[model samples]
Target: MRWLPVLPAETGEEFSREGQPGDAPAGEGLLSEGACDEHSVRADVEAAAGAGIDRRVYFEVFGCQMNKLDAELMLGVLNENGYQLTDHPSSAGVILYNTCAIREQAENRFFSKLGHLKKLKGERPDLVIGVLGCGAQNHQHDIFRRYPHVGIVCGPGEFLRLPQLIDEARSQGQVAALDLDTPVRFERKENLGPRPRHAFVSVMRGCDMACTYCVVPRTRGPEVSRPVNEIIEEATVLAASGVKEITLLGQTVNSYGKRLAPGRRIGLQHVLYGLNQIDGLERIHFITSHPRFMNPDLIEAIGSLEKVCEYLHLPVQSGSDTVLRRMLRSYTMDHYRKVIDQCREQVPGIALATDLIVGFCGETDEEFAETVKLVEEVRFNGAYIFKYSERPGTSAAADLQDDVPEEVKRERNQVLLGIQKRISLEANSESIGQETEVLVESLSKKDKTRWSGRNRKHQIVVFPSQGDEDLVGDLVTVKVTEVTPVVLVGERPGKGS
Candidate 1:
C-alpha cells in the first residue's frame, strides 16, 4: 500500500455548504477496461463465504452513471474480500463515499456529508471511512489533511485495488492510491455482482477532449478504448445473466476507437454492429457524445440498427459560436446544426437531448439569446441545464474570468429551463393515445400501483401493474393516458388497442 502524507488535522465540524474548495478539479468521471471470467469469481465467493457472513459496507455514491457503476465494481471487490454491502451507514463497519467534483453544488454536498460522517467516525473508530472517485483524485492526500479520520482516499482508476487499500488503512491509519498512470486490471475473480435488467457497459474510458471548463481528462487520465472482443464478451455475459438492455458508457462515446493500438482503431459504428449481433441483448444505447466525432457513418448506424435505441445525448455546451470557441469545443453552430439535421433526417422521431451550460464565462445577453434561439429551433425532448461554475486547473479557470454575475447566470438558466420545460411538455403530450413499448424496471416510487420503465426514445413511461404478471424486466405494450414534462403516465394496452 502506498502511504499518503497526512495533512494537519482540522477540527471536524458539521457540513457548512460553504464556498467552493480551492482544490476542486473539473468534472467527475471514470475510465477502465478489463475482462473477468466466471470460474475465478465463483472460487473467490466460495473462499470468502464463511468469513464475510457478518461484515457489511455502506456506499454513498454521487455524480454520473459512471460513478454508480464504479460503486458497483468496488462493492464486488469488497464482497470478494469477505465484506457484505449494507444500506445504513451506522450499521456497517466500512462506509465509502463515492465522491463527485463536477460542479460546486455536488462538491458541497459531498463535503457536507463527509463532515457528518466525521461524527460517526468519532463514535466508531473501528469503522473504516473512505472517499473515492473524481473528488478523491482532485484532493488526494489533502483529504487526509482535512478529515484526519478518513482511512482511505482512492480514485476511480484505483478501485480495483480497494481491498488491499482498505486492509492497509486498517493497519497503518491512513492510505491513498491516486495513481492515474496505472492501467486498471480486472482479474477474472472480480465479478460485478448481480446483473439488473438494464446495465451500463463502459466501452471506453477517459476523455481526450480539452474542453476549457471540463476536468474529465485530468481526473480520468487519457482516453482508452476497450478491445471490441472484450466488450462483446462482457455483453454476452450480461445477456446470459438476463440483461435485456445495455447502455454503452464513455465520456465522449462517439470517439470510440481513436486511442487504440495501430491496427485496432475501430469507430463507434463497428462496435454497435457487433453489439447488435449479440443473441439475448434486446436494446442498445450510448451517450455523452461530442459533435466533432458524430460522423455520417455513425448517423447511418443509428438509422439502420434495429437494436440501437432512437435516442442520442449530444451535449452542445453552448449555443453561441463565440462561447463554444472560448470553451474550446472545436465545433461551430453551423456544424452542430448540420449534425442535428442529419440525425433527424436519418432517424425520424428520435428523441434528442443535450447538456446546456448557461452563463459561461463572458457570455453576454445577446449570446444567451442565441442559446434560446437554438433551443427553440431544436425543440429538444429533454435537456440538462447547468449554470457555469469555474473548475480549478481547467483552461477556463486559468485563462478566462468568470465574469457572468450570479443574477445573470440565474436569469439565463431559468429562461432556458422554462423553454425546455414547455417544449418537453408539448413533446410528451403528443404521445398521448399512442402505443409504445416499455421495458418494465421497477415500481414507481410516486405511485406504487404502477411500474416504471423507458421506451426506445429513452422516455420514462409509468403504467398500472396488473398484479397478475411479473412485468419487471419484460418489454410490454403500454398506451399513453397522460403526459408530464418529465414522465408519461400510461396503462397496459387492451387486446385491440
Candidate 2:
C-alpha cells in the first residue's frame, strides 16, 4: 500500500513492460562545500555514533522490485547505523533517491526530481542529497558534474558502504561510491520499517545476458546469486513477520544459482522448494525470467509446488529471429514457444505474461508481423509493450542503426497494444463467476470505498470494503462479478449484494 514511483517496464527488459513489481502500483537538501580525508570522515562518524545522533533519512525509490529491495537494504543499513526514517523529505537530514536507468523517461524524471532537491538544500545547509542504484551507476560522472550539491552517489555494488559513504559525503565535498565489479554483501538480516503482508525478496542482483539494448548489465553489474541458506533465512524472517506472500526478484530470476552452484548444480526449483517448506508462507512467486533458462525442471516445479503461484513473466523481447539474433537474446522463437508449451502443459491455469519491444534497430515489416503472430499464438494474459529507444553505451546504440522511424514505432506499439487488449479482456472475462482468493492490500486509489488486492494469477481485484477492520493482510474469497482489462471487479460471496 506504500506508494513508490516505479517503472514497471524496467523490471526486466529495457523498460518495465512486463513483470512489474506490482499490477499498477504506483528529496532535498543543501550542504557546505568541503573535502575531508577518510580518517577524519570515519572519526567524525564514529564520534557522531558515540554521541547517538539519530538523523532522519528519507528514501525515494525508483525502478523495479530489485531497486525496491535495494532501498529496503539501504534503510536497514541506515537503521542499523543509528539513523531513523522520515516520510517527509523536508524533515529529513538525508534524502536518498534510489534510481533506475532502464528508460530515458525514468532517468529524466530522476534528474527533474534531483533539481527540486536543490531548493531544499538551499533552505537547509546540512541536508545530504544522495543518488543510489541504477541511475547512480549509469550517470555517475554526469550527475556529479551536473549537480555538485549532491554529496553521495553510490551504485548498487557500493550499497554496503552506504553508512560510511553518508559520513564521507557529509565531510567530503562529493563522494562517489561506484564499485561495479565487487559483489555486494547482503548477508545481514534486517526488516524494512513496518512489514507488509506481501514482500519482495531479491534472490540475485545484476545480469550477464549482455542484451544489445539493455543497460542493466552496465548498471547493476554481473549476476550474483545470494547463497541458498541466506535466501531461505530472509524468507523465513519475512514469513515470521506475518508476510504471507514473498515475490523473488532478480534481473533474470530463472537464471538464479548459476554462479552459486558448485558442480552438480542447484537451480531456482531447489530454492523454491526450500522456501515452500518454511512455515507461515502461503504463496511464492518470481519474476523477470530469461527465455534461455526456462528449463523443464523449473516448469515442472511450478506445477508440482503447492506454495508456488501460477504466474510466469517470461520476456520475449522480439519474436523475429533476426531482431533476437541482433539483440543477442540467445534464444529463437521456436525455443520460446517450446518453453511456453512446456509451462502450459506442466502448470495448468497459469497466467502467462510477456514483455514486447515493438521497434528494434533493424526490424522489418515482416519481422514485426512475426512478433504479432507469436503474440497471437501465445495469447498472453498481460503484456508490457514498448517503443524502442536507443540507450547510450548499449551494443544496439553503438553497432546497430536506429532505422525504425518514430511514426512507425508508434504505429507498431498501438497495433500490439490493440491485439493484447482483446486477449487480456477475454482472459479476465473467463474468470467471471469463479471464486478466487486475494490478499487484501489497500483501498483503491480511484475509490476508497473499495479495497484492492491481487489474486493468485497476479490480477488486481477490487471489492467493496467490508466493515473497516484493517483487512490489509487478510485473505478473503471473492466471486468475480465483472471484468476489466487490468482489474477484476468482485465482491465477497454473499455480502456485497
Q: Give the top-scoring candidate (lDDT).
A: 2
Q: How far is candidate 1 from the true structure (C-alpha RMSD, Å)?
A: 8.4
Q: What tens-digit string does per-residue lDDT give for candidate 2 at 1-497?
A: 22333211111211123211211111000000000000000000111223222276766666655666777777667767877656567767887888867666556767887898888888876888899887798888798889877999899998877889888877876799888877776643644422267777788888888788888888877888888899899889878978898888778888888769678687899899999999999999887688899998899999999999998888787889998899888999999999999999999999887777877888999999999999899998877776787777678889999898989988888889888888888988999999999877777656778877778887778888867567777889999999866778889988864
Whole-model lDDT for model 1 versus the true structure?
Answer: 0.72
State candidate 1's TM-score: 0.87
In model 2, the Cα lDDT at residue 76 comes to 66
**TM-score winner among the candidates?**
2
Which pairs of residues collide in model 1? none
Candidate 1, 91-187: lDDT as tens digits:
7777787876666666776787788888888988888888999889977857998899899999878988888888888889899888887886432
List the pairs of residues colliding in candidate 2: 8-16, 9-15, 9-16, 9-17, 10-15, 10-16, 17-384, 29-121, 30-121
* TM-scores for every predicted model: 0.87, 0.88
